[model samples]
Target: MKKIILTIIYILTLSGCGLEQDSYLVRWWNGNIPTKLSDKKEKIWDICFEETKYLPENTKEEKEKADMELNNCLHEKGFWD
Candidate 1:
C-alpha cells in the first residue's frame, strides 16, 4: 500500500506540471491565452497568438473580435515599447 501510494503521488505531481504552468493570462474577446512567464515582449505575443488560435466552429466575427482584443491586450501589457 505504501509503495502504491508513493507511485500515485509521483504520477499526479508530474501530470499537474502540464496544467496552469503559464504565469501570464490574457482574457480576450472569445477566449484567453496564457504564456510562460518571460520578460520578452515578442515571446509573450507569439505565445498569445500561438495558444489562442481559433477552432473550426469559431466564426469570422469572433476572430475579428479576438484580433481587436489581442491588440488591446498587447498594448495594455506595454508591448508597444
Candidate 2:
C-alpha cells in the first residue's frame, strides 16, 4: 500500500508539472492577447509582423514556427504588459 501510494503521488506530480509548463509565448497569448486595447493592437502587430516576416511559412510546421516567433516578438515588445 505504501509503495502504491508513493507511485501514484509521483505520477500525479509529474503530470501536473507538464500541465503548467507552457512556454512564455503561450502564457503571454493566453493572459494578454484577448485583453489588448484595439488601438495599439495594429501598431504592435505591424512591428511583430515586420520582425518575423523573413521567416518562411511555406509549410504547416514552418507556419507554426513563424507564428511562435511572432508571438515571441510581441511578448518582448511589451504586448504582454
Model 2, range 1-81, lDDT digits (tens) per residue? 999999999998886576444666557747843445676777888999998999999999999999999999899888767
lDDT per residue (tens digit) for residues 1-81 in model 1: 999999999998897676553433324322556555556787768766665555232789877777886777677667767
Best model number under lDDT: 2
TM-score of 1: 0.37
Kindly give the stretch of ten consecutive residues in candidate 2 with the minimal lDDT sum. Answer: 17-26
lDDT for position 7 in model 2: 100
What TM-score does model 2 achieve against the real structure?
Answer: 0.47
Q: What TM-score against the true fold does each predicted structure earn? A: 0.37, 0.47
**Cα distance off (Å), candidate 1, residue 62:** 0.9
**Judged by lDDT against the true structure, how good is candidate 2?**
0.82
CA RMSD, predictions in order:
11.7, 8.4
Pairs that collide, model 2: none
